[model samples]
Target: MNLPATDRRVLVSGASRGLGRAVAQAFAANGDRVAVHYGSRASDARLTLESLAGEGHVLVGGDVSDPAGAARVADEAGQALGGIDVLVNNAAVNDPHPLATTSYEEWAEQWQRHMSVNLLGTALLSHRAARSMIDRGTGGRIVNVGSRGAFRGEPDYPAYGATKAAVHALGQSLAVSLAPYGIGVASVAPGFIETERVAHRLVGEEGEAIRAQSPFGRVASAQEVAEAVLWLASPAAEWSSGTVLDLNGASYLRT
Candidate 1:
C-alpha cells in the first residue's frame, strides 16, 4: 500500500453519512486532516466530525448541484484545510425516476439535477483542486465514488446510472490531462453497499435476493468502500491513475 504523507489534507464531499463519513474516518485514521462537506444536514455532519479520530478536521456545507455553491465549498475547504491534497467526490443523489412511469417534465428535472450534481459539481471541484495542487507544486490525488450500476444498468434510476457512467469517463479524461502536473485521478464503482440509508432494504424481504447477487452471499459494507478509496488516494497508487476499480463482489462481471 502506498501510504500518503502524514498530515495530508483531504476533502470529502457529502460526508454527512454513509460512505462519505466512512471515507472521512479512514483519512483521519491515517493522521490526515479532513474537511468534511455536507449538503444540508448539519447534525449528521457534526456526527461525522465527532466520529473522526484526530484534530484539525472541519466541516463545509453546500449543494453540489449549484455551481456557485460548489465553488464556495471548494474554496472554504481549501482555506480551512490550508490546502487540500486529496479530493474525494462522494456527493451524489440516486433519486428514482423511471422513464416508463414518470412524466416527461419530472424526468427532465431528475436528469438535469443528476447531471448538474454528479458530473458538473465533481468536475468543478476537481478543476479547483487541481489548480491549487499545480500552483503549489504539490502532486495531489482525486478519488471519485462511482457505482456498479453504471455498467450493470438501473431500470428505476436511469439518471443515477447515467451520471455514474459519465463520472467514470470524467475520471479517465482528467487522469490523462492532469498526469503532467503529477496529479492522480481514479474512480471506484461499488455494488450495493450496506449503508444506513439502505439498511431497511438489506433487512427486508429483498435482503436474500440482494445478497444472492454476490457469491459471498452478502453485500459490501461502508468501510469496505472507504478502504478502497483510501488506497486509490495513496501515493503508492500514483501509477493507478485512470483506473476504475470495481467493488462489486463478483456480482456483475465485465467481459
Candidate 2:
C-alpha cells in the first residue's frame, strides 16, 4: 500500500467507529494526516483517536447536521496539517422505522439529522475543500459513503434510503461542477455490511439468508469498503470521476 507522500492530509467524518473508523485508518496507514470527526461520541472518538496509525491526527468533534460544522472541520484540518487533500463524507444515521407507523416527529428528526450530515454537511466540506484545491491549483477528491438502499428499497427505514438517494444525486451534480476546478467527486455504495450496530437487526437464520444472497455468501467488512474509498481517492483512479462504485458482492445490481 504505497501512497504518494504528497497526499498526506485527509478528512473523515463520523470517524469515531465502524466504517468511518476504517476509512480514517486506511488513510492514516498510508501516511495521511487524518482529521477524525465524530458527532456526540466522545468516548468512541477517544478510542479511535488512540488507534490512529500516525501522529498527525486531529480530533474534530461536532454535530455534522450543523451547516457550519463541515466548514469548521475543514478549518481545523487545515490548521492541524497545513491543508487537506481528501474529504470522505461518511457520517450518517440509519435508525429504522416503518413509514406507515413512523411518526411525523420521527421522520422530521431523521431527515434533519441524516440529510443535514449526509448531504448538506458533505456538500459544505466539499465546497470548502474545493476552494482550497482551486487556490492551490491542484486536483482534489471527494468520496461520499452511500448505500444500496438508495436504489433498492428496504422493508423499513424509508427515510434513510431516501437520504442516501439524495446523496447519490448530490454527488453526481458536484462531480460535474467541480471537475473544471480539478476536483473529483464520487460515491461508494455498499450493501449489507456486517457491523456491530446491525448485528441486532438479524436473527440466526436471517443472517445466513442475507449472506447467501450475495454471490460471495458473506457480508462486507468495514475495511473492504474503506479500501474502495482509498482507491477512488488515490491518483491511480484520478480519471475516474463521477463514479458510483457499488462495493456489494453482486448482491444487487444498480441497473
Candidate 3:
C-alpha cells in the first residue's frame, strides 16, 4: 500500500536549522504535520517550529547518538505526530580531524562520534520507525540525508565520509528488508549546501573554490535539497527506494 502524500505525520531529526529546517518546512507546506527535532538547540528549533506554514507541528529533543535517547526521540515523535508516516534522518556530526595534524586520541574520538550519530543513530531510528510502520500495516517512507563526501571523499573529516557511506549502505539494506512491509527507504547525497553553519565558508577564496566545484558555479540552497527529500518520501517515489539521489549540481559524478 502506498502512504498518503498529505496529512501525513513527519519526523525530521536535527531540524533546528539548515537543511533539516528546510525539509520540515517543505513537509508542513505540503499539508503534513511535522515533528521538528533538535539535539541541543531548543531555541533554534522553536524558530523552525514557528516558521512552519501550518499547525499541529511540534518540537522534539534528544541525543540521537545514544541508544536510549534515540528510542525516546522516535517514541515521542510517534506519539506526538500520531504515527510516523515519514522519517528524515538528518541529524549528524561532521568534525574535522585531519590525520596529519590531529592526535591519535582526537582521531579516535571523532571516529566514535561520527559512528555513533551518523551511523548508529540513523540505524536505531530507522529500526524504530520501520517497526511502527510494520505494526500499522500502512506504507511509509524513510529518507536519509547522506553527503557527497560519502563518494567524493573528506580527507580532513574521514570519519564523516566513512560513516555517511555506511548510512547509504544501511538505507539500501533497509529498503530491501522493509519492502515486504511497504516501507520505502532512500538517501540523498548532497554537495556543498549553503546553510547558516557554513555561511562563513561561502565567502572569499574558500567560498569561490567551493562554488567552482560545481558546474553551476554556485552551491545548493537548503530548499533545493529539501525538495528532493520531499519527493523521495512521497507516495510516487516508492520505486526510487534504495536509490541515492545526488543533488550536487554536477559537482560529483559516480560510475
Candidate 4:
C-alpha cells in the first residue's frame, strides 16, 4: 500500500501510557497508522490503541531492555504496520540511585538497566527501522526521547542522566551515518513532564519547586512533547537531522 506522505506508518515505543501514548495519538490524528509498542503494560497499550483517532493501529509488546526483545519488537511492528516510516524511541528506565546512599551493587545494576534500555534499545531499534526504510527506498524519520537531565544532570538518578546523554550522542551519530540513505534522525531533551508515572512527585512543596525551575511556572505536558516529536518526524523537518531540540521551556539554558 502506498500511503500518502502525511499518512505514514509510525512505531511508538512505550506507547502504553504517558508521553509515548501522546506521540502515538498525535500521529494517528494526522492520519498515520501507528504501532503502539509496550514493555509490560499490555492493558494500557490496548487503551492507547483504542484512543487513537485513526484506524489500522496495532499493539506490539516486548522487553526493549533485552537485545532479542528489541529485535522482535522492531520486526513485529514492521510486519504489522507494513513497514515503519517513523520510529519514536521513547522507552526508558529512570530510577533513582543516589551515590550518597546507594550500594555498589545497586549502582551497577541501575547503570546496566539504564544502558540496556535507554541506549542499547534505541540503537538496536533504530538500526532495524532504518534498515527497513533503506530497503523500501522510502526514507524515514527517527526521533529519540532524551531528557533535559542529560545536560542539567540527575544527581539522584545518575544512570538515567548518563544514559540519556549517550542516547543524544547516539542519535547524532546515526543522523550522520544514515543521512545518505535519506533517514533523518534527531533527539528531544525534555524537562520535567506531567505524567501518570510522575504524578506523585508533582505535588506538595517539592512539586512547586520543580515547577518553578521553568519560567513558565509549569512542567511540560505529554501532548506538548509529542507535538515536538511529531514535527521532528515530518518531511519538513528533514533538515533538522542531527539536531537535539530542547523542550524544557527555558528551564536550563546550555551555552
- Candidate number with greatest TM-score: 3
C-alpha TM-score for every candidate: 0.97, 0.93, 0.99, 0.98
Instruction: Please state the error at residue 190 of candidate 1 in Å.
Output: 0.2
Model 2 misplacement above 4 A: 1-7
TM-score quality measure for candidate 3: 0.99
lDDT-sorted candidate list, best first: 3, 4, 1, 2
Q: Residue 166 error for model 3, in Å? A: 0.4
Residue by residue across 1-255, what tens digits does model 2's lDDT show? 232544467889889899999999898888788889898887887788889886868898877667677678788877887777888999888877786888889877876776776778777877888788778776678899989988887658776788888888888898999888777889998998877778865568888898987999998999999999998998777678888999889999977
Clashing pairs for predicted structure model 1, backbone only: none
lDDT of 4 by residue, 1-255 (tens): 122467798999999999999999999999999999999999999999999997899999998878899889999999998889999999998999999999999989999999999999998899889999999988899999999999999999999999999999999999999998889999999999999999999999999999999999999999999999999999888999999999999999999
Which scores greater on lDDT, model 3 or model 4?
A: 3
TM-score for candidate 1, residues paired by index: 0.97
Ten contiguous residues with the weakest lDDT in model 3: 1-10
lDDT of 1 by residue, 149-187 (tens): 999999999999999999999999999999888899999
lDDT of 4 at 28: 94
Please report, in order, the local distance difference test score of every candidate based on alpha carbons: 0.93, 0.83, 0.96, 0.93
